[model samples]
Target: MNKAQEKPIALSIRNLVKTYGKVAAIDNVSLDIASGEFLSLLGPSGSGKSTILMAIAGFVTPDSGEILLNGQKIDALSPEKRQFGVVFQGYALFPHMSVRGNIAYPLKLRGIKGAELDAQVERTIDLVHLSALADRMPRQLSGGQQQRVALARALVFDPSVVLLDEPLSALDKKLRAELQFELRSLHQRLGTTFVNVTHDQEEAMTMSDRIVILRDGAVQQIGAPDSLYNRPSTRFVADFLGRANFLEGAVSSVNGTELKIDVKGIAVRHAKGKDAAAQGEKTLLALRPERIAVVSPDQAKTSLNRIDGSVQTSAFVGSQYVYVIDTPLGTIESQMPAFEAGPLRQPGAQVAVTWSPEAGVLVKDK
Candidate 1:
């Protein structure tokens, strides 16, 4: 959560490549996961996120490259020797094993017994706050509780790193959200290195200190949640991480960090980063719906990024109104907070979608 750069490198992957015959599962990946940091590998199915995690856990052998722990290569090590705690989606708790038996399984495998094993099991159950359900079987526990048991089982042996493969994906939405909060709190409390793989964007963003976006077996962008969300490097990332309104335009002018681009004959200002170049290349800009405001046509003021559009459709989604507006450029989605006093921005209504220059981010089309 803090300056992870100064911390020791817990895991490092250099030029990692793996292929299943003709298909490439992981392609030329390099990453450094800092000690005591929570990093999420987020992507759709078959994006190589799982393959990378498997390689780190020594479950899958990569076709090339190296995996280092504390700067020591461990590619030839087996899964058991890696000592990484892994929690799968199924919770994988033995049906016959009680909560206590499940959490004590790993320790028992190592020949620990008697008072020491009992104390370790008890301590881990308390860590996950599963004391009340320690005697319950997997069939009797709720999905969340079963997940907690799986976590306790994973942490009982105190591995150097923990790998979670969508552990909360089996639970209900409410339960999932609750466990997400719990996971975040637990990570902070334990300060253990966690590598999570999930297809859910909000889940990754909610619990991860940093997120690595993978696309078709390669890394697209890696950064903090806010950086990846607000300043996505590519079009796929912007579209995947969140809802985005992409506007393609030709570069009109560049003034240091200020950029002016022409989009469908409508000029929009863009705020550029330090590496922004004036290569006269056409660029795409991503605008988040939440950053856009719906203004009544009569009260709309001329701004740097104000467009008159008709609301094609609008849905009242609890706290906000999500509208699909059609303009000359294309279909744009805008989200506005629900107000108690005003009329809703309904369908076929004329409105102005206004946003600041800072709201538009330049992203790579590829």
Candidate 2:
């Protein structure tokens, strides 16, 4: 079992349901967040990611279901009583107060004063590497610095959990990437159960120990980043987590653990693991672009699956070259590492795409 599974449950949502007017914003969703695990609620806008986060923070009351903390239900508790630190998307830093004051506010609210509050504020500030900027106001600090202040404030009280709602969404790409690493490191050092909400797939995959994917106010899938990315249970997951090329076909033959799918008369070999499709059953294969290799038609075909196609379009994307290949089945997208992609394949160039049977994962059509 993974470390997360070994840890005790810090929070649990049992059959959580929340509705807005006639729409169910969070539809019968349930999840267990292990102590010290960094779990991200990931999905597009209006997918209920934020709604679930708000519910956990006690900001939004659910119509049904229970929110538990350390095995005890806290559904009736107010936001502050739950002792779950929250970092809003806007940072919500106190413009009138200095960083030290902002960090000390939570402690002050609890009647903590004097050396105790000062020490806690100082320790939390240093924890987020903001000791030097303790006296700076929110307006005087950079976006990243302001975010650190917000985090320090949330953590000062030593809350049972920290809830982040797209905390890094306001920063630029480079700064955001830098903070993502820092935030992950902070989580490791503190071992605090962090429940984050985000729409950015890369951000979710980068910082999460495990991710809960939601869609249309309901849970879609929940698993470790690599597990969900490599062996997605559905087409939605396969496409949402990363770029995926789908091949629709019917199983033509089954040989022990291996199965062959007939895609427009082309035999696409697939490995049937636990969830196997029966022979003649319609199947959908989610193939990652990076798994496909574009080679000359005369190149030796050692892989189980190969298809002849012409490069429809090609573009250099920093570390990799992305190509759109037009094949009999459909337009297949392939991403080849710049180091391995010897020369750019021009449009209309004939090529053969190859991938191993193990590379294609069978996913539900839905």
Candidate 3:
């Protein structure tokens, strides 16, 4: 299986460019989606995530470049000839159709009928766990059930690839989370290549095997969720994926693997990463808010990185306490779990803020 996985690419988007009048919706985007893998195109609204997806679906014609599926050029193929299953944002089910009718729509379109259609519809309804509600109308089904119907409709045709466009965006937070897990499980069961588009970072992180982040109609970074979260390639990626503290400063000294930076009247030390500029060059430290801590004076006094700050504001979340510290390096946010050994600092109280050198990630100044 591993050898087969390395044999050939499943889908390749090479320098795909789509322009509408003066605007370039998909600006020279390229990607290689592996067989039986789940990939996500994630970005905020108007970032061209949907445009790239529509291009892949053959709905939008590109100005240049090529789209290859299984090493075959597919840019000229019509949407129907592409043979890719697509689940749109809205359920898009026919209101008059029953759950079984909706699930069997694609199979019907393929000209399958009689016992074959009945068997396929039964199998699909069972696959989506909608056997009990097969007779229910679209208006009678819940949002989650309707979503399952949509998914069943997409998978009923047996397309080798599946495209989902914010399939669970209409659901509540908890329901959406539940459906994300369900979608992952379905993908695992089917072993079909899935390319999903969404702006929800958590959804992208939890559901995708890899995520492609887009900005200004181009791909900014493509990697596993953890890799993208831990080592963001750009400031836009770091800020968009999650909350990060931007510490701007100039490099003061470089000693082997460690480098010292002068930031906001305070000297802060960090590990020298590949993206770090040369000595004396300005850089920005991208530190996760949760990585910083409010240390007591007796907790491991170190000369490397230390700052005295007052708590500008504090909030007690259910599982943790969030604090904003007003220091020389602007306002740095820190999170402390509620079950920790000691009491947390109150608002307007002086506290010692500290983070290890490894916790602070240095990148090119943005």
Candidate 4:
């Protein structure tokens, strides 16, 4: 088991369901968050990621089911009573409040005073690297700085859990990337249970120990970032987590731990997974673009599953070259590192794509 799984449960959501009119915003979702584990609720819009976070924070009441914190049910607790720090999408800093004042507000609300409040505020500000700008107003700080201030505010009270609702979505791409690292580092340093909600796949994969993928109003899959990305259980997950090229075929034969599939009359070999299909059963294989290697037809290895194709198009995407290869199976996307892709293949260049049997993950056709 992973370290997170070894730890005790910090929070648990059991049979959580919420609805509006006839639509269920959050279906019967159940999850257990390990102590100090950074978990992300990730999905597209209207997927109930935010609703689950809000329910945990006591802001949204569930239609049914219970929320337990450290084994104690807290379904009746108010937002403030829950004592969970929340950083909303908007920084929501008070215009009149200085950095120090904003971070101190939480303490003051709890009746903390004088030296105690000031010391806590200063320490949290320093933690977020905003000590130099303690007196600056929200308008005076850059977007990154403002985000830090908001994070400082959340950490000031030293809550057991911190909920972040797409906290870095408002920043530019570069700043967002920088903050993703910083936020992940902060979570580690603080060792606080963090439940983050976001629609950005990269952001969730970057900062989360485990990701809960939701669709519509239900949980689709929950697992470690690499596990979910590599062994996605459904078509939506395979497509959502990253760029995946799916090969549809029927299992022609099973040889020990491997299965040979027939894709458009060509035999495709795949390593058997837990849900290995029976012979003659339809199968769908999820192959990541980066797993495919483009080579000259003569250079293809017999041990690997090889498909003859011609480069339909190729685009250089900084670190890698993404190629659209037209093969008998269908159009397949391949990503190769720029340094190793050799000379770029022009349109209609005859090439063959090869990948190990293990590279093709068996996924539910759905």
TM-score of each: 0.96, 0.98, 0.94, 0.98
Compared with the true structure, model 2 gives a TM-score of 0.98
Instruction: Answer with 1 or 3, whichever has the higher lDDT.
Output: 1
lDDT of 3 at 216: 80
TM-score of 4: 0.98
Model 1 clash pairs? Answer: none
The whole-model lDDT of each prediction reads 0.90, 0.93, 0.87, 0.93
For candidate 4, write residues 111-220 as lDDT tens digits: 99999998898899889988889999999999999999888888899999999999999999999999999999999988999999999999999999999999988999
lDDT of 3 by residue, 39-99 (tens): 9999999889998888889988899999999999999999999999999999899999999
Tell me the lDDT of candidate 1.
Answer: 0.90
lDDT of 2 by residue, 102-161 (tens): 999999899999999888988998899888888888999999999999998889999889
Estimate, for each residue in 281-361, the C-alpha lDDT of model 1 and write its tens digit.
788888999988777876667677788999899889889888899888899998888874167777898888888888878
What overall lDDT, based on C-alpha atoms, would model 3 receive against the true structure? 0.87
Worst 10 residues of 2 by lDDT: 297-306
- Relative to the unseen true structure, what is the C-alpha lDDT of residue 209 in candidate 3, on a scale of 0 to 100? 85
